[model samples]
Target: MAQHALVTGSSHGLGAHLAARLAADGWKVTGLGRRPASETPGTPGVDHLQADLSRPETLERITDRLGEAPDLIVHNAVSYPPRPAHELSLAELEDVFRVNALVPYRLTLDLLAATPDTRFTSIVVINSESMFHADRDSGAYAASKAALRVLTGSLADACRSRNTAVATLLLGPLADPDKVAQLQRVAARRGVDEAEITRVFLRKSNPDLVIEELIDFDACYRSVQYLAGLGRAANGMLCRLDGGSAGSLI
Candidate 1:
């Protein structure tokens, strides 16, 4: 039988791409997001579960929808609103934590409890480089991600007796159209080519890095796949798919 995978925040970005890629790789994929099922990524065998992670109540239906435990669970849902530390409101902080940390914790526990008979081989949490180095106006987002990273460690400890492996992926800025446009603007402002600007930024951030500057969606998918393939022997591990960004900082 093919392995089953559950991916949260599969409506767009890395989650959507990862879900589609897993489906194409012959894994039975279930995507959870707020968008309508039809709007999810194009994968013929994938099932889309519509839920808003910001609301804890919506997550109650996850176990009912799966009917069984999945082999791999990827927590990729996140709320990223750029605001300075002083400008962050209570509501905004709560919202970010709800989606980034609380929902993933609840869902992981729910699935683990619901699937007593089945073994969850791996749980992958999608994290950001900001968890280590917070950028300007990203205090709230960084704090939430840092919390998620800590949660990943705690979850890994809890799963040790059950032989379930947990992996946290720290990723850098992905190569997308919006990011490309932003890079272009920076390039124009610095009077340098986009490639040169990217190189300079990466070098300035971390001089020890030899990997590529930008991480793409496919890189994220492949990294998750590698984690899932590690079986139960891997245990708790922090895997960086950031193209050496984290290596430079720490």
Candidate 2:
């Protein structure tokens, strides 16, 4: 049977790539996000479900809309301008956690409870390199990922007793991103040309197909997991390249 997979933050970036990759593997991929259709990534055959994971009220609807428990689930949402350590207001900190960490944590509980009878489901999470090394001025991002890493262990423990499978995809930096235009804008503001910015972006994208340090995995996915197939890259419909070490990956 084709495995059913759910990927959060599927509106773009890592979630988008995982959705496309899984679909290519013959799994039924579902993309979940709060963004409108225009903002969503174009992953053909992926069922897109948009619901704000932060709100408690929408969960029931999320469950209703998801239709069935997934065999695989990838938590890949991210936050930008990652939380600062000292000045992070309660809202500022919690806002990132709500999407990047907390929702994924809670959703795992719901997913497991909803599918109690299953012997195992392949679970994958997208974690940060920052969890290993602190990024400059991004303590909140590091903390959020670190907390999730702990939670991943906890959930793996919880599921180990239940015979469910879990894997974590730790990323050093994504080679590809959907924010080229935004990056270019920032470069312009800094009085730098866009070509120079492009060169800088390439250098920062991950050179390796996979890196061990950045992701936290209790188990592993034994395959080369590119976000999209060649057509997406060749035609330039979407830019899902990995980034150098300093990628805007959070």
Index of the highest-lDDT prediction? 1
Per-residue alpha-carbon lDDT of model 2 for 55-127, expressed as tens digits? Answer: 6576667766887888777787777544356777887777777777777888888887888554456566677
Give the alpha carbon lDDT tens digit for every residue of 87-173 in model 1.
888887888998999889878988887665346568999998876667667778888998998888898888878858888888876
Best by TM-score: 1
Q: lDDT of all predictions, in order shown?
A: 0.82, 0.64
| Candidate 2: RMSD to truth | 8.6
TM-score of each: 0.88, 0.70
Candidate 2: stretches off by over 4 Å: 81-83, 178-250
